[model samples]
Target: MKLQQLLSHTRKAVDEYQMIQEGDHIAVGISGGKDSLTLLYALHGLKRFYPNHFELSAITVDLGYEQCDFTPIKELCREMEIPYHIVKTDIAQILFEERKEKNPCSLCAKMRKGALNQAVKEIGCNKIAYAHHKDDIIETMILSLFFEGRFYSFSPKTYLDRMDLTVIRPIMFVDEADVIGFKNKYNLPVVKSACPVDGYTKRQYAKDLLADLNRQYPGIKQRMFTAILNGNIPGWPERIPYIR
Candidate 1:
């Protein structure tokens, strides 16, 4: 997607949900992946002209992978002039080597989020931005339906009362295809994930299933997204008048 289109979608979500407030300091969770890098770029651009005026800090939770190189990401953060932090941990060793979890994604995600939240708090950030896009939202809903027997997806804005952090998804309206296009067009410092089960996960299964469903039924994804927005799911912020 073009930069303008990205900004439009991001601003729409941010405005509709009031994700950013005056004097807000947001810590973006960067996983050294395409989605997160695209988010960083979008948020950086939004920060420039956004009327509310907020600050940004790019953060990454290192999963203790020796091969995971973050040099390019660091350089990109430098160019963007956003403070970057990487919380190094033995999460990989704990999940894969020590525990040998059959489903490492769940535990790994919990630990990673815990570490990321702590880091964000230490840096005095009240909000944390996740890189979940439209596809992720739908896929997560499907995953919950198939596995947990619930029809639910994440909200655009959520309050983590326990941690005193607000989570926002500014790019929730952007499609995965658009994210890929933006990443390639801008030559985002895309780094390969060194995790052992990068592509082999239940979420991947849901993604592939969604692709197949979209292929079989055209415009199905768009309909699903619209349903998500208007379905009145709990925790979804009602759209409010946006004031500059």
Candidate 2:
């Protein structure tokens, strides 16, 4: 997808959920992946002419992976003129070596988000933007149903009262395929994940299952997304126009 198309989808989500406010500063959580990079570009493009005047910054929690290089990400942020911050932590060591947790994704995610939230708060940001997209939303619902026997997924907007921060998914309307296309078209410097279990997690299983189901029953992904929007799930904001 082109930058304009990305901005359109991002703006629609932001406006629908009232994610941004005047003079609000949002820190984009950069995982050095296509989704987050696409979000960075989308929000940067949206900042140019959105009705609300909001500031943008980028943050990445370095998991201390030796193979992961962030130089290109820094260059991209510099080129975009957005302030970028990297929080260095030994999360990889803690998860894999020290703790040796069998299921490290949940704890690793908590640590990463904790680090990210602290950094974002220190930088005086009122909101944090995550890059979760349409496919992620659907996969999460599937995971919930399969694991917990419940129909639940993350909301587009969430308020962390304890942290005094609001989290927003501006690109929730964007598709993962579009994210990959944007990365390829724009030559986004996507740093390959160095985690050993990068593609062998429960989420990955759900993702594959969702893909298979979508192939068998065309438009199943869209139907699932529509259900989430209209499911009246707790913490979900009021329903808004469904944008592609």
TM-score of each predicted structure versus truth: 0.97, 0.97
C-alpha positional error of residue 200 in candidate 2 after TM-score superposition, expressed in Å: 0.3
Count the clashes in each prediction. 0, 0
Residues 41-97, candidate 1: write the lDDT tens digits.
899999999989999999999999999899999999998899999999999999888
Among residues 3 or more apart in sequence or in different chains, the pairs in candidate 1 whose N, CA or C atoms overlap within 3 Å are none
Q: Residue-wise lDDT of candidate 2 within 50-153, one digit each (tens)?
A: 88999999999999999999999999999999999999999999999999988899999999999999999999999999999999999999989989999999
Q: Which parts of model 2 are misplaced by more than 4 Å?
A: 242-244
Off by over 4 Å in 1: 241-244
For every candidate in turn, the CA RMSD to the true structure comes to: 1.4, 1.3
What lDDT does the true structure give each of the candidates?
Answer: 0.93, 0.93
